[model samples]
Target: MNYTLRTALQGLWHDKWLNLLCTLTIATSLFLVSLASVAYINIKTISAKLPDRFSITVFLNEDLEEERIKAIISQVQKHKSVKKLKYISREQGLADLRLSLGDADYVLEGIEGNPLPPSLEIGVTRRAVSGDGVGRLVRD
Candidate 1:
């Protein structure tokens, strides 16, 4: 058995290039498989988190009256799928935009009045994370 092992080692030493190629091939395959597995896990994690971040923002017409805006908010709040509802006035929207823009708020200096319209931000509940549930809520 020892003689056979010595012969095998001698053969490998004589064909060093072939042994190196085989070793490199095995290493490369393992590296690629590991990389693919990591990517698959990351994708699954991101997709699972997508539902929690799902939301619906309804942009109301600028001419909509205060009463109509309140009515819309009330209606949206009554929906079973709605986990939370928030009303963003034109002023609030402008403020938020300014904050987001940081120093770029100067770009809006030439604009006359807040052109931004009021909007309703609705958060969907965990139970309503399904595609159909979100679609039904939007349709209704």
Candidate 2:
């Protein structure tokens, strides 16, 4: 026991720098692991708070009549993947564009009269956001 203790102490003293380096490496590795774990947890929490619904925009023909638009809306509503939907008229689209452009909207004014087409905004359920489901939605 005495010899073993003496040998152990001598080894530690002789390899003090190496031991310190190894200790620091382990501590740094542990710290990095802990930081990654915390980052992963935080990212998971933030993602969980986001809505599960995915949005899709469908632009309608510029000359579509109100009745035709209604028919299209009815057709889209039949899809099982769609959780919610909203229709935006061309004027509304233009107004939204103007709002987004701020003062630069004057550039659009000289181009044409209501050049934007009406559109439908759909919110797909999380389960339907898969590739196959999205493909089906696109096909229909």
Candidate 3:
């Protein structure tokens, strides 16, 4: 007999089928949206990882002193937008080349005295790997 807010809500609660339908519809919508959000985030993370795949070869002068190389590397590290720098010694490069050219005797023979240069593979942060940023880094 009481027509209070509680009593009115109790009437809606009696419509079990209708309430269940609404609940399922809302849950389904939420699940779809959440899945889309996760996919979008995955795409973004993969994009960031892609930058690590991009590399810049910093060729060292054949006779560059170790001190000079270290000094340049320090400056490169200080760059605000650099994410990571990986150094590859000449021996490592030669080894990698040999591994890649397995069974190619001609390719192996043609390379002499570790012609490959010691270099750093630079991976720029998401904000700095663009064409313009690469040019600026090379220029500076």
Candidate 4:
């Protein structure tokens, strides 16, 4: 074993530059593989969280009666994937827009009236964000 070790060491010493190059190549490959794995994991995590951010906004006609709006709300609620529902009145939407605009709210002041429409903001389950679930919801 000692003789084998001595021979191996001699061979490595004789080809020191080649050994170093091989070592560096192997290390670089491993590092790249590790980086790719980390990137893939991070992408998967972000994609999973994407469903939580999914939402649908349904704008109602300005002249729709309260009863029709209620019916629309009921219909949306009947979907199994519906997780949360919020109704935003025209005034509330304008307020929210102003809040979001901050100092830029001056841009909205030129408008004579609230141009935003009343709408329903609907949050859905993760399953609803994938495949044909969203399509079905929109169709209904």
**What's each prediction's TM-score?**
0.85, 0.72, 0.60, 0.83
Ten contiguous residues minimizing lDDT sum, candidate 3: 105-114
lDDT for residue 52 in candidate 4, whole number 0-100: 98
Residue-level lDDT of model 1, residues 45-72, one tens digit each, is 9988887888888899999988988888
Candidate 2 per-residue C-alpha lDDT over 1-140 given as tens digits, one digit per residue, 9 for 90 to 100: 99999999999999999999999999999999999999999999878655474688999888788899999999999999999989998889989999999988778867868888899999888777778888899899
List, residue by residue over 15-96, the lDDT tens digit for candidate 3: 8789899999999999999999999999999986887677687888779889988898999989877789887888998888
1-140 per-residue lDDT for model 4 (tens digits): 99999999999999999999999999999999999999999999998889999998989999999999999899999989899999999999999999999999899877998898899999999889966988888887
Clashing pairs in 1: none
Candidate 1 has a TM-score of 0.85
Q: List candidate 2 stretches off by more than 4 Å.
A: 1-19, 42-53, 102-110
Best by TM-score: 1
Output the better candidate (2/3) by TM-score: 2
What is the lDDT for 92 in model 3? Answer: 93
Q: Provide the overall lDDT of each model, using Cα atoms, as 2-decimal numbers.
A: 0.91, 0.89, 0.84, 0.93
Candidates in descending lDDT order: 4, 1, 2, 3
